[model samples]
Target: DPEKLSDAIDCAPRGERFDWLLSVNINGEILSPLMWAIRDGKFALAEYVIDHLLEIRADRHAYYYGREKLFEKHPEVVTVLCSDCPALMDTLMDGLMWHSHSVNQGF
Candidate 1:
């Protein structure tokens, strides 16, 4: 089921991977396919979502923090993000420093 789910994500519309969102609810929150992938640690599927999203120039305001969370949990995932979403590289280090400081300060 997971592989099929991943394939569906890879084949979905420009930036709309979770068409099923219309019918399902999780903890009173609507979670997109990208969010599901990130929550499940499916970085490869998340990369596909990000790549397709960038290809269409989709607004990433919702998922940017998800990417940062991914990068924090699995540093290697940043390479995929940097390759597909180069603009992030510009502020990646600065963001990392700020995140580090916040966590160190227990914020």
Candidate 2:
């Protein structure tokens, strides 16, 4: 289910400018599980969602679908974590960092 949840989270497209209707979108689509967990006060699941969203995979495509996309879709990620799940703050922060690997992909 983690894979499914992550896929859903990654479905968020940029510049949609769609009206956010509290927990649902103007298109009547439900928000991601991370938002659901936070809205429902389920901190544990929120942590898991955040971890999965920000996980670093050693691949080029990952740059497009990982942390950068997360922040693009939900810039409030850190703000919510800072206030709601302080413990995972370090994990979230660490996940934002990319290992140089001594050679740039020139991205």
Candidate 3:
């Protein structure tokens, strides 16, 4: 299954496009492969997906909702994401502040 998932990522149409990878729509839910992996508690699979996704050059978008969920479920995944994609660290920091505000505002 992992191998198949990896192959999907490799052979996906517009595989070089971050938007395509990060904006997979499942029943109108915006989820990426990484998001699905994290949501399913597949940490090893997530690590593999993250490493592979970062290897390609493209305009990467932050799946903020998925990211927030992942951070809440496993902060270490955020650490690994930042390490693998430093550009996303800024977005993560911004989201952290936003999350803090939401909690403070009782949202």
Q: Evaluated with lDDT, which candidate comes out highest?
A: 2
- Residue runs of model 3 more than 4 Å from their true location after superposition: 13-17, 56-107
Which candidate model has the greater TM-score, 2 or 3? 2
The full ranking of all candidates by TM-score, starting with the best, is: 2, 3, 1
TM-score of each: 0.33, 0.55, 0.44
User: Residue 45: error of model 2 in Å?
Assistant: 1.3
lDDT of model 1, residue 8: 57
lDDT of each: 0.47, 0.59, 0.53
Top model number, TM-score: 2
Residue 12 error, candidate 3, Å: 2.4
Q: Worst 10-residue stretch by lDDT in candidate 3?
A: 62-71
- Tens-place lDDT per residue, model 3, 18-88, is 45445477899877666666567666666555444444344365222234334444457566655565554
In model 3, the Cα lDDT at residue 103 comes to 58
How much is 107 displaced in model 1, in angstroms? 38
RMSD of each: 11.4, 7.2, 10.8
- Tens digit of lDDT per residue, candidate 2, span 1-107? 55555465456552221112123543786676566777778767666666655554444433322565567667897788788777878877766766675765774
Tell me the TM-score of model 3. 0.44
